[model samples]
Target: MASSHPNVVTLHRVFDSPTDPYVYIVLEYCPDGDLFSMVIDSERYLMPPEPYVQDRSRTDGCPVPESPEYVEERVKLDNLIKTVYDQILSAIEYCHSLGLYHRDIKPENILCSADGQRVYLADFGLATGERYSTDFGCGSSFYMSPECQDGAGRRLTQYSTAANDVWSLGIILITLVCARNPWKEAVLTDDTFREYAKNPDFLLDILPISRALNDVLKRVFCIDEEKRCTVSELRASIRGVPRLTASNYETWERLLQRGLLKASRPKEHAQVPVEKNTFSNPDTNSSPSPSPVHSPPNASWDYGPKQGKFGQGLGPFAPTSSDDSWRILEKGRPR
Candidate 1:
């Protein structure tokens, strides 16, 4: 069921292997491996050496850095994490809209681009069309929702697949930002998450992430499945923040291509930052200024990078629910 969505992995074609009784799928090539490796490797690489250490040697210890280099690295890392999270949420929303629930959502199942500009959700073997199924408890233990976990008798409890996916998303986001998993397994049963639940700000207190993200995470990892944020609601909560979307996908691709072409030429190097409006505030009625687009040297061949009519339009910043949500109702149907 793969499509041409930027966030979801693209599937070109499917065929059967004549030599064996297996079906083969042709998928996009992601040289950067999976999200799990990216998180762990980046942390180790970004970790500064010991006292008076100047070499860029890899170490087993993941020590936090406080130097200016660290500041720049952090900014880049945060932006990447935010982008990936937004894309994953959007992809999941799209999947649900099509009556599909990815029963398995974890780092190992996600693939990232080499340049770290994009991520694609992969491994849908456990995906199913039923949203409220209780027959099977499938998914990685560390990222499974409490309801989806096997009980004392190894019976699969009834659960909402959407909520279960949301739980996995929460775990992924926390891991990306903190560069570590807060709990080994069993989110509700884990002491770390229990403490954070008592004081929601505990996550912000530990990680140097934005309060906006902290609020989203708190809603995402709710103990009660009904209370946990849906993919649409989660998208709305972070709608105000700047992110890339399909609407402007072409614009970004062109900018990236141009930058890469320039970067290849010697002595041609520059960097520019794009700025967009924060249309999320409910009190504001003013039209937002145009979003800034730039081409920087770091925008290699594979890389580089709007708020609401405040959630009144489509895409990530689109409102959780509105009349416009039904605007394109029958237009996309093939009669």
Candidate 2:
């Protein structure tokens, strides 16, 4: 089914090495690499003004126009996000049509073409045919849905895999535009996520995304699986958005002045306490490693156990920054 879809990476062949006891799978090449790299690159070059600067500008009255080069680059990036996201949605929609769900749908699983305009949804190791699954904590910590995390300690019997995929997609879209994850995980243990759970529109206060996109994300991130927007509905909503980034500078200025956008600026070198093995099921004190793959040279995994209300294991995790504990897991999966 994946091979039949143009937006999905085609699997060519599978083989086993008789000597090394290993299996090799060949997949289509994506020259520009995964969407994770694209997002990291965008973060370095396209991030919005610092929080302090925004505050100062607000107090000083009004804001200035963005530089011509910055505006041009932002437009290009927004277009790229829309195109790549639309392709991803189409690929997932196709998978759903076949009664298959890609349980893991982060940026790392999405590969890009030479020009970076085209994208192919890759990595189906976590894909499943079941409409509902008992496999809690089945995806990356950053992108997993609340119900999938079962963070409330309710021990949910099962969750809608399709809805879980949609929730992950919402996080991915926000990351594409803001170059940051709204929170590390969806559980109440994470402060950022806790605030979001309390206020469905919390993202509007922090992310630079437009109000139109926020409305769509609210539906996408709905805690109720049955109430969550479907992939097709999400695709249509995103298409109708005029722009992904905030357009009303004056409104943003006012919000900043009133301290409503206080969380908009990330703390510098702040050590945020994170629950280890928060992804693991509370019922069973076991942490399941997603998959073993090489880590990037610049990154390292920390598997040390840290005691927290959620669990006793810290991570087989890579921390993106001291301030934001967003983990990009198993990015080097063979393809």
TM-score of each: 0.59, 0.71
Mind sharing the TM-score for model 1? 0.59
lDDT of 1: 0.56
Task: State the lDDT at 36 in candidate 2.
Answer: 72
Off by over 4 Å in 2: 15-23, 42-60, 64-73, 151-155, 248-335
Model 1 misplacement above 4 A: 17-19, 44-76, 150-157, 204-210, 239-335
Q: What is candidate 1's CA lDDT for residue 307?
A: 14
Which pairs of residues have clashing backbones in candidate 2?
none
lDDT of 2 by residue, 47-138 (tens): 44321122222333233455667667767767767887899999999999999999999877888885667889988888999999998888
lDDT of 1 at 15: 92
* lDDT, candidate 1, at 304: 8
